[model samples]
Target: MLVKTFRGAFVCTALGLALGVLYGGWTALGVVAILAVLEISLSFDNAVVNAGVLKKMNAFWQRIFLTAGVLIAVFGMRLAFPVVIVAITARLNPYDAVHLALTDKDRYQQLVTDAHPAIAAFGGMFLLMIFLDFIFEERDVQWLRRIEQPLARLGKVDMLSVCIALVVLLVTSFTFATHAHQEGGVHADKGQTVLVAGIAGLITYMIVGGLSGFFEDRLDDEEEREQEAEEAAARTGRSRSAVVLAGRAAFFMFLYLEVLDASFSFDGVIGAFAITNDIVLMALGLGIGAVYVRSLTVYLVRQGTLDDYVYLEHGAHYAIGALAVILMVTIQYEINEVITGLVGVVLIGWSFWSSVRRNQALTAAEPDSEAAARVSVP
Candidate 1:
């Protein structure tokens, strides 16, 4: 499993090194290595959350995730996305954006950074929705019982997450519109750009989720399910395929995965600018790390790790919440990527420890609890 999980990551590293050397020199290899580590640390929680979605997909879509999805994640978001954003923000042609990135890297990165508020608002709101929806779900196994239970109850309200997100955006964009701090003489303003971007993000979440849900439900309707059940019975639980190979459902799931990847990349892209404004280097470095993250997501799904660690999703969502707020705050200030990475690591680590303790308690109590039950029955 270790070899299987890391094989792609190793390959990506080798490519990164080769590309690094070609792009610059031996020193570029070191930069790529650092950026990969930074991206991995910051996105560990993303892998966990992705597993929750990916497991529902069949083997074919899973393969696509490794193959096609990797392309979207690495190049689509890590490379082309920044270029596209620069083009849109600066009103430059896509060709000029790429040219600017390749030649005048500093100006390109500045343009990207100058678009941070809108980027932050969009990504932050989407991620906040993910976090809110998770925490508000009425699950039997609660992590922060006191707080989670109330949030769960509040989940009964329709669009609750959207309301909360909009409220926060309104306050941030208005309250700090003029007072936005300066970075390298660039002002962070919360105006139409931020609001429009945020709403766009919110709408994106709804549309993606709705489309995926529609297809998923149609695929699992009662009649088709019974047919599947009958087929399974005839073949000892091995059912026939039905457009399941990158099917409609899988297609929507692909879109969802891409959007999710974009959200996660939003922070990494902007943050990478702070470290190194070179788009080529950022793409190579972060792209390597992004592949490893996808690898980790697949590993978690195959291993059923989420089932073993019940609170793991909880921790990941919490990390997302923290990241969402931090992303928003970062629009007006510079935050160390190390701090961002550390916060996620802490939450995930603490949840892992809690899972270990829970398992131990269950194991320790089994014998005594069974004995007591037997005695009572007699």
Candidate 2:
């Protein structure tokens, strides 16, 4: 299993280097490594979000995510998508975008900047949906029932969200739209297109985010049942059926992992534009991020880290929610990617540390009990 886990990542890294050598030589390798680390850093929140969702999927989907999903993420979205965007928006010939990225390193960065607005819109809305759903959706622990109850009730219809989106669009169109047009004048027409595209992306995010929630709820139900069966089996001293059921739950968790992986990769692909636009660099960098993310997910599952860090999961969901709002607003605001990433990393990192602190406190409290037990042990 360990060998299989690393196999695809190794192949991708090797292939990226081979192509880099043919295309741009050793400089390309340096670029790839730098971009990979950047992407990985920018996407730490993605790992946290993936862990929360992955606990609910089956194993088959997880394998597909590590294999095919990585390709789509690293290649289609990270590389080709930007080139395509540049071709359409920059009025550059599609071949020119490709050629520029390969031969003229200086110009490739220009095309990437030109490509950012549209992709940024997509990513912003995508993340917004993630945040909204996680916040509003019902969860097993009603710890924050005071806040969650109202949101969950409202989210049931999603009418409020729709209304809020409409208000945003209307306000943006009337206010920002006029301002943007006044500044750009003749190019004002394009502003409308950009606005429409942003809305479309937001709608798409809502659909995907809702689907993720639906699937997650179902998986949670399955987990509860499996847990009940395991408890019953333990009481009866029946091992075989309980073990089989545990295997089934594990498979579900793997599937959940894959879907979550795909969701987290959305922003990584979008953020890859900050580096070299050479398809090779984008693929290499994003692929490296994928490798570490997959490893992190597996580690979390094997160690049951999420179970230990209850608030860490909560922090990730909060980050996702905040990111979504930022993404939506940035459609017109031109927020920097580094800022977006850092915000999420800080939030999730704080949560993880808090979880660790909590666990430590629990452990410390337990030592006294252990000492008492020793004192009483006959």
lDDT of 1: 0.84
Error of 2 at 95 (Å): 5.4
Provide the overall lDDT of each model, using Cα atoms, as 2-decimal numbers: 0.84, 0.63
**Per-residue lDDT of candidate 1, residues 178-282 (tens digit):** 465443355544566678888898899889978987887876784477776777777885555444423788789878887988898787877787678777788
**Winning model by TM-score:** 1
TM-score of 1: 0.92
What alpha-carbon RMSD in Å does predicted model 1 have with respect to the real structure? 3.2
Q: What is the Cα-based TM-score of model 2?
A: 0.72
Best by lDDT: 1
RMSD of 2: 5.9
Candidate 1, residue 29: lDDT: 84
What's the lDDT for residue 250 in model 2? 49
Worst 10 residues of 2 by lDDT: 177-186
lDDT of 2: 0.63
What TM-score does each of the candidates earn?
A: 0.92, 0.72
